[model samples]
Target chain A: SAVISQKPSRDICQRGTSLTIQCQVDSQVTMMFWYRQQPGQSLTLIATANQGSEATYESGFVIDKFPISRPNLTFSTLTVSNMSPEDSSIYLCSVDTPPAGVYNEQFFGPGTRLTVL
Target chain B: GIQVEQSPPDLILQEGANSTLRCNFSDSVNNLQWFHQNPWGQLINLFYIPSGTKQNGRLSATTVATERYSLLYISSSQTTDSGVYFCAPTPKAAGNKLTFGGGTRVLVKP
Candidate 1:
């Protein structure tokens, strides 16, 4: 398993503001994905961050609202723009490695807990 | 789009007991995984069983791809196992994208 970390484990932000959460991995990975888990709900895919390309967002989500940046193979950043109370949730980052030696499983970070007021 | 379902939305078990968690998918998949989200809210990957069976210490999982269902067995459960268990499925057609289930909340009392 790869070690992943997210900065500012928990944060409280005001409405109309923005916060960028950073995800770093110990080793290079092929694919990185961002997900959100609202209170008392299941996880939802936000976007897939690919190096040197615009992130692929799922339906009901837009780049203008949640912008993603992947500058390198082991680091990525997701910015929640113009936050609202409805955006309060846990943001998680996942990575997929080569499935050669073992069943390549998606490794998740300790997630960033964001609260909008 | 694939649909994922997990059974026993809420469960209360005693320490040293055994329990089974079920995951059913609406479509065939090449990838099926189980995750445990502890009280701390950290998602820990438990298994990557797309088909057949695999075991890890006190936990084991089996996925019947043709049947579009999977099973997670916890042997000799501990208080630490109290948390939400999630099952995610990824269709082979999709490039490793996972759709997660609603999850089953387990509470193991000592």
Candidate 2:
């Protein structure tokens, strides 16, 4: 298992503004992902951050609206672009199968709580 | 897309009670994970059993891969166990992407 951390535990933003959330893992992992959890809702996969390439976004999500960058194995950033009140949600980062993983359970960061007004 | 159904949308339990939560998925998956999201919203991994049974402390989980369903058992529940429990399955065809269930919200009473 690896220790993970996220920046600015939470934030309050105006509609049409953007927020960039950073995810840092303690060790190198084979997979890194971003998830969105709207208020009173379950988690939804936003994208998969590739180590050296552009992210793979899920349906209903686009690169322009939620651009992701993974420059290496242990760090990735997801920016919610041109945000709106609908973008208010908790953004989470998760890692799976660290280099030395055995059980292969995915672990999550504390998450960044965003409020759009 | 995989359809996941979780039963008993909400749960209320007395201290030291037992409970069972079920998650039914629509397709074959390479992995199924159980997570507990605390009041602070930090998700704690409970199990990674794609099949078979595994136990930790008073919590245990069983996944019947062939049937595309799983069960989570919590015995002698405590107040700290109050939180949202989610089951996320990674489809074999979709690789590592996790599709989550609607979740079972549990509240443990003293």
Candidate 3:
């Protein structure tokens, strides 16, 4: 429903470093989100980036660890702070495209694969 | 926060065969989605069927919201269809928060 793109399709970083994953949508969306997929696990919501405001992080996820930025309706960034091997996973950005007169549905990006050593 | 469950954690199929993937939710959901994550880890949205039925190409999905379950049907499966299938559901008021199931891994052999 929406064309989404993420930068740095992949990265290999040393522990203690941080990486910022960027997500850009072709058009404006009502909502944007960041999700993390750990090894052998399902996708987990990291946070919801609110345009021009602070993000709302999910349980067990802290803003200090996974900071999010939604500068505008079409762009957002998620930074994995103080990286560790446990932080290695696929980070995905998604946007919602609501049906006309109906509820919204989410579409995801290709994902940014991050491997921390 | 809702609990999502998927059946048959893994499935092996022959090319040109057909398969059905199931997703069940613990509570009512205002929005239901099915996704196919390719080997490269790109998540492809297969269906956004909050209710009723929707189809695209050889893939179709049916969501019986009243029953709290959804089914994804793949007709004439191909090698490309081999991947992780995930089901995510969110309440209408939850905004963009989605609770994803563990996912079903599918392997197709030609």
Candidate 4:
């Protein structure tokens, strides 16, 4: 299992501001993902961050609104640009564990709870 | 894109009771995992059963790849188990992206 941690466990931000969340993993991984869990909603994949490459975002998300940076194998950052009340949600970072035999699990970070007002 | 669904959107169980959570997918997947989200919104990986069954302490999970469904069992439930449970599956054709289910909210009473 991989240990992942996110900064700013909880934060309150004013509308129109941006928040950059940092994700750090204990071990090097090939794939790191960003996710958003909105109020009363399921977790949605925001993007897939690969080292030395541009992150592949999902259908409803874009690089402009949610820009991502993957500087290395063990670290990445997700910046939620132009925050709004609707953008308030818990952001999480996860790493795809190296395949151990037949099992490869994705471990999640503690998550950053952002409240925009 | 594969669609995932979890049954019994909300469940109320007393301490020491046992319960089952189900996750059904629209297509065959190469990876399936169960996760528990505590009240504080921390996601804890429970199992990574793509196919077959596996158990760990009070929780067990079974995933039938052919059937495109999985089941999670929690026994001797405690108040600490009160939280939301989610299942995510990655389709064979979908690279590393995982599609998550809506999740089942469990409330354990003392």
Task: Give the number of the best model, judged by DockQ.
Answer: 3
DockQ ranking, high to low: 3, 4, 2, 1
In model 4, state the lDDT of residue A69.
98
- Name the candidate, 1 or 3, with the larger DockQ value: 3
Identify the superior model by lDDT, candidate 3 or candidate 4: 4
Candidate 3 residue-wise lDDT at A22: 93
Q: Taking the tens digit of each residue's C-alpha lDDT, what string does model 1 give over A24-98?
A: 999988889999999978899999998999999999999999999999989999999999999999999999975
Q: Score the docking of each candidate (DockQ).
A: 0.61, 0.65, 0.72, 0.67
Candidate 2: pairs in clash: none
In terms of lDDT, the best-performing candidate is 2
Lowest summed-lDDT stretch of 10 residues in model 1 chain B? B89-98
Between candidates 2 and 3, the one scoring higher on TM-score is 2
- Number of clashes recorded per candidate: 0, 0, 0, 0
Q: Write model 3 residue lDDT over B1-110, tens digit each, in one string.
A: 67889988999999999999999998878788899999999888888888999999999999999889999999999999999999998865675478899999999999
For candidate 1, state the interface root-mean-square deviation in angstroms to 1 decimal.
2.5
| Candidate closer to the true structure by lDDT (higher is better), 2 or 4 | 2
**Consecutive 10-residue window with the lowest summed lDDT within model 3 chain B:** B90-99
**Candidate 1: stretches off by over 4 Å:** A99-103
Which parts of model 2 are misplaced by more than 4 Å?
Answer: A100-103
In model 3, which regions exceed 4 Å deviation?
Answer: A98-102
